[model samples]
Target: MKNKIFFLSCFILLSLTSFSQSISSSPYSLYGVGSLYDSDFGAIPSMGSSGIALTPSNFINNLNPASLGFMPLNHFMLDVGGKAIATTYQSSSKSEKRNNFQFSHFAFAFPVTKKSGFSVSLRPYSSASYKISDLKLPILDSNESYYLTAGGTGGLNNFDFSYGYRFTDKFTLGISTALLFGNVDDNRTFTILNSITNIHKKTDYNGFRATIGSQYKIDSTFTIGTTIKLPTQIKSSKVQTVETVADEVLSVIESNTPSDVDDYYMPLEIGVGISKKFKKALTVNFDYQKSLWNDTRQSDLYGDFVNQDRFALGFAYLDEKSNFRKYWDRIQYFAGANFDTGYLEIDGKRVNNASVSVGINLPIENSLSSLNISYSYGQKGRISEGLIKENYHKLSLNLSLDGIWFVKRKIE
Candidate 1:
């Protein structure tokens, strides 16, 4: 049964890779590097992405690398996941709906020693795919307005490497290094009276960032964790083309000109989490994170940066009595909620998000291997003049497989 499950998971992983490039689209993606992505792995998605203090004895934990230090000896773990989203975008005047499917992440981990572990992963960091047509806005210092049309695509990818070391039976420390790289393509058209102008640009970006984390076990059934992400800058360069047309005449101001642009700055972030168990069958997890974007002193053409806060809470339940004869006894159930005070401020208003989710982990065999499925509904932004709101439903699927190594069969 284990071998069959492993091969089936491998097939699904390969099939999903082809859709990895598909990205969710949003008008908010027009800002910064695109909409920031959530690539949580395993049952973490079902738990509202609140697993920073979880032990990694059965599955990989992407939130806090320090959790890796607790990996069971001689065990290798693999995780892969994807998401499907259906969104409704609304303005005071109209509403539109869209659907998207995209791959989330791929990761693997293994113990390096009895007291240490290592892992690596690849995932998208952001998505900048959006389209806006015939948006009317007043010209600066003038009552007259211009009509604008714009579209963009592309974003950044993250490659991460992490290591954890256990200092004692109850304490662990870890570090993670991430490489961010990608390019964005944008085209905009503006019509003011009789004259029309068009601009096309492609910007490339690259950067590196680091995070440090620690976890401490308060007792047999309680743990706490903390993580700090350092600030960094992403360098950028762009190639652009500009043209104008008026009175049946066309003019090219610049053609494929290359130049350096302002670098994007990432702010320092801090997070804390706790996990507690009750009666050996129920578990609760909670997390809070803060991003000091205001300190970055960054402003966009359409928005401003502000400090951000995120909160997540989750609960899980399972039967404590093991019954090999009953498969349902091994299943686990989870539910969670999350809220974010976003970092983007437009017209003195902050965009925010709130969501609730529920899911289950279905055991594949007698091991820790399982298939995770989750559903969530969320709302982002608010309905107001000059701003849009988004209501979305998301479905997440993940496969986690566990294997043992370095042990020989006695009967063989």
Candidate 2:
């Protein structure tokens, strides 16, 4: 019980992110999912990571109800992972670089009945962290200069409850709804004093995300599965309050006033994915998904970084001798590619990026996770020159602590 509780504590702490500043680009958020989450939760192993996602149909696709139909376990599963980022950037006048370790994700899934299951996942759904410091005294009468730095975090973080049910021997259905919460903190320091201001804006957005899929076994040599997800709706409150150091020291500003900002919605996607296997161990999955970004643009709480198309190819392998897996295939190892097209808005213009990425699986002991590391790289083009673009790269690791509690049947 202690271990289970300890594991859950990690989830609560993880939701409270942002001790530093980072800028990650996402086809959705202009930069990645803000620092709130891994832009491609294993979607891209390297730079060119794009699209619906190449989730291995069995244990990892719990978020998608159709994917839950693939679970062979009557038990439970828990997953955890994180990543360290080393990023550098350049334009014309100056170049900058920074490094930091960010908490990536944590998840838990379990069964509810003989043919039904449920899951709870805590993850950052979106984020905002920015830091800029410069003194205006440059050549300033060459006399004096004072520098100030400030960092803030905001956006959607996800807490969800899901259920999956197998209606027939070959059919399964799933639905998951999520609640989003936003937290922001502003820390500032200058030549005179240091202070921290808290901006807490709460939003209650209920979204319905579900999938319907089925599987068919054609003898032992062939098996196939397919799934589809409906569009989602996210609604939330748009009230913001900013308290300054003077407000804290002098009690000057209105600390509890709510802003009259309007509520907004996040874009939804229509997805279809399929999987095929031969002899169990050797399997392949291909997913095609189109996000209906335009559907929510005017009502979208998010910016123009929304992507309309995302594609992914994923595969896995195992060292035949591994026994952790229930299927004939022992150690599940996989590799795949991706391509995405999306618009990025900066100075009132939409800059489109065409990016690609690929990756492989490395399982530690043939479970839902291992000491697995995936890498990817991709380039965005169109405006500047031939490769006038964004080069993307990522490296991430996954870990899990899993076991079963067996109640031995006593001989009567």
lDDT of 2 by residue, 363-400 (tens): 33334443345665545443321112345555555444
Q: What overall lDDT goes with each candidate model? A: 0.90, 0.48
Candidate 1 TM-score, true structure as reference: 0.96
For every model in order, what is the number of clashing pairs?
0, 28
Error in Å for residue 411 of model 1: 1.6
List the RMSD of every prediction in angstroms.
1.7, 8.5
Report how far residue 264 has shifted in candidate 2, in Å.
2.0
| Candidate 2 vs. true structure, TM-score | 0.66
Alpha-carbon deviation at 222 in model 1, angstroms: 0.7
Question: Which ranges in model 2 have alpha carbons more than 4 Å from their true place?
Answer: 1-36, 39-58, 132-151, 184-257, 278-281, 299-307, 319-332, 343-369, 379-392, 406-412
The estimated TM-scores of all candidates read: 0.96, 0.66
Measured with C-alpha atoms, the lDDT of residue 249 in candidate 1 is: 96
